[model samples]
Target: MSRFLFVVPPLAGHVNAAGAVARALLARGHDVAWVGPESALRRLLGDGVTVYPTGMRPYGGQRDRGARALRSLWEGFVLPFARFTRPAVARAVAAYRPDVVAVDQHALAGALVATAAGLPWASLAPQSMELTEPLRALPRVDAWIRANLAAMWCEAGLPAEEYVDPRFSPHLVLGFTTPALTGPAPFPPHYALVGPALDHDRPDEPDFPWAALDPRRRLVLVTMGTLAEDVARDFYPRLVAALAPLGDRVQAVIAAAPHTVPDPPPHVLVVPRAPVLELLPRVGAVICHAGLNTVCEALAYGIPLVMAPIKHDQPVTAAQVVAAGAGVRVRFGRSRPAELRAALTEVLDSPPYRAAAARVAESFAAAGGAAAAAIHLERLATS
Candidate 1:
């Protein structure tokens, strides 16, 4: 059996996707291990899993939007993260001696180390941003990114010629989204759109008052994701006010930071966190910040969305949802209660939205998830 090692970032979402794929590989009787921040991996995959701890330096929170945010993301986090984790990843490779490494898109150090060690590696994209040509629109930004990657390669003792978009692996790049959700794009031949690797074996299920939800009303889940807790603090109150008008016709489940809202409306259920996979099936519609994980999870259950993109890859994901006819978009910062209510109403009242979401769901199912990713990685190792 071929041994596989997964190298992931400290971020929970990225780790979750990699962990799912790791679980799949283990199920196939292949030896699978992980290398990353021990805390993050343990939080996602549990303490039973084997993981080599890679030290991490947290990014100083910079709350910029648009182009500035993109710049900050690269300069502030990506570059530093790669440099900081390179030694740990290299040590892991030398000690573990895995046949192949599955590298998360954000964790460039893994790719560099694998290349330097002459090991086959695959890129695992937890989100769709890397699949699209994000830098095509801005040549200067593309150049800037390329220059930074080249510099990082040099520092890691790898040849600059070997560098070509660290976000993609030269041998194999696995995307966690279907073309239906990503729209028409010229992807490379080595890229496999393997859809989302959803974790079916969730060991811990949060206690949610399922019976408390109104059975008579259509349920709508309102969440801004984990990273957007600060943004949600401001957005949730408006969302609650917007959904208040629906009253008995529509019930809302808002996942907000603890005590963000002391007294929510009668129609709303405010929870610090909810079991999303458990809750998605029961909800008829979702109003969110268009996070890729949430979007794919919702579509997997054939639930429609009302997207309000705040930052990062959210706008791109929202655009894809709108293009695919699966959701409606509203302004995040400026949207009032009336506008939110209207958009939520449109998604719920329109049959076309549900139909389009079902189409994407079909595509997601056809594009094999964790199993397909494991097969591809196995082929890469054995080829």
Candidate 2:
């Protein structure tokens, strides 16, 4: 059996999807392991999983909207974290001796190491990021990103003549979305547009108050993901204000930092965390920051959305949702209560939104998900 090593970032959403695909590999009797932050892997993948320690440095402190956010993301977080973890990833490779490496799009070290070693690797890329080509209009920005990738290649001591963009693997690229959401793509033959990896093999989270849900009320789930908690401080109160006035028809369950929504009305439930996967089935709608993981998860359940995209590929992903008719978007920080309310009402009450979501869900099923990702990885390994 081929050995597969998954190299991912410390971020939970990245790990969650990787964990699903890793488990799928294991089920087929291949050996699978991970190289990333031990604490995060243990928290998400459980203590039993093998994780090579790559000392964690948190994401960049600068969280905002637009081009500035993109700069901070690469310079502050991606490139820095890549340099920090390169040694550990190389060490993990030497020790595990994997036949194939699976690398997240942001985990540049994996591609660098595998390529330098003359081993095949597959990019577990986000549809919102590489597949969407969000930076095509910003030619300078695109060149800036490529130059950094080239620098990282040079730092790995690989020859400049043999350079390739580490964020994308030449062997295979597994995207976490389908053309149904991304529109038709210009990607090559090796781009595998597997749907959201819904196997989500993590252990069950049982703490959510299922009884607190009102059977008669149309339920909405609001989550900005863990990374967006601090940035969401002001957004929550405005969100609360928007949803508060709509209590006659809707109640919201917000997964947020403590006290973000102070004195939340009985119709709203604000918690330190919520069992999102478990809660998705019961909810009719979602209000999110348009993080790809959240968007895919909400869509997997065929739930419509109201998106507020803050940074990076989120805005692009939000646009895709709007184009697909699965959701509507609002300004992240500047959205007034009336606007937020209107967007929420549009998705929650509109039949077209739910119908569109279901259509996307059907496409996702047809594309296959974790199983398809595993099949691609296996072929890359065996080929």
Candidate 3:
């Protein structure tokens, strides 16, 4: 058995997906250690994988307000978080000397560390962050891009230009998205389009009015994801107000993060972030931030979506969903309660939307996620 190290940021989605990949490796008799975030250690340990906790920050605030989301992404991700993580990853890699490192595509620290160690690295992308080329076209983002590249350069012993150039080491990129949902053409040969990695078979103590769910009602699962609790605090209340009109017919299962719960709404069943796989299957539609994890989950379950693509790669992913005909988008900038309500209503009531989503679900079924990942990694070791 070969030693493998998998690096993931602390967020629930990232940890959950990466943990599954690690477990698959372990199950196949490989020595697996997941490195990143103290918060993830408990979960990884429970999944039967060794954990090397690195200090990391979860992005976004409990408030889902636009300003808070933007600030959180800036402070939690593009700033001090990445700066603080590099040395921690370097330390872990030096001590472990893993034969192969499977890292989240956005985990630049892990990528840098693997590059410096001269270890083969494969990207286990939880989102479409590294997929789109249009991100380079953003205004004034090049400065941050250059700074980030310089940091990566220092970490990997490469010139800064290597970061910007399209050519470099052959990276094996595996996306948590079906080919049906991704953008057209120009995909790198090393990149593999895998389906969403469903976290759990089912929840242990699945609660949230499941038994009391109104059969006549259309259930809408409104979530911003586990780490996005802060963002939900700001957004869920507004969302509740928007969907309040459809009260009896449309019951919302609002899974806000702990401490972010608003005043109870009669039509909204508020839970402190339940397992999404459990809740999503029962929902008729989902109103969520365009985090790739949530998007792919909704698609896998054949649930139509209305996305309010907030910070990071959300806008790009949301656009892809619309392009795929599986979902509709609530345009960013001055996005209001009425707009969200309208978008949700339109998608839920539309037959074509559901058909498109179900079609994508078929595509997802064909894409063997964890198993394909296992075979690929096993080959990496054998080769």
Q: Candidate 1: how many backbone clashes?
A: 0
Q: Which residue segments of model 3 deviate by more than 4 Å?
A: 44-47, 56-79, 155-169, 201-209, 227-234, 257-264, 332-337
lDDT of 2 by residue, 244-343 (tens): 8888778789988767777788899888788888888889999998988899999988999999988888888999999999999999989999999999
How do all models score by TM-score?
Answer: 0.96, 0.97, 0.86
Question: What clash pairs does model 3 have?
Answer: 61-230, 61-231, 62-230, 63-230, 63-234, 64-231, 64-234
Candidate 2 Cα lDDT to native:
0.88
Ranking by TM-score: 2, 1, 3
After superposing candidate 2 on the true structure, give the runs of residues whose Cα lies further than 4 Å from its correct spot.
204-206
Model 1 lDDT tens row, 55-76: 6677756477676767777888
The candidate that wins on TM-score is 2
User: Clashing pairs in model 1?
Assistant: none
- Superposed by TM-score, candidate 1 places the C-alpha of residue 213 at a distance from the truth, in angstroms, of 1.7
Model 1 lDDT at residue 280 = 86
Q: After superposition, how far is residue 238 of candidate 2 from its true place, in Å?
A: 1.1
Alpha-carbon lDDT, every model? 0.85, 0.88, 0.71
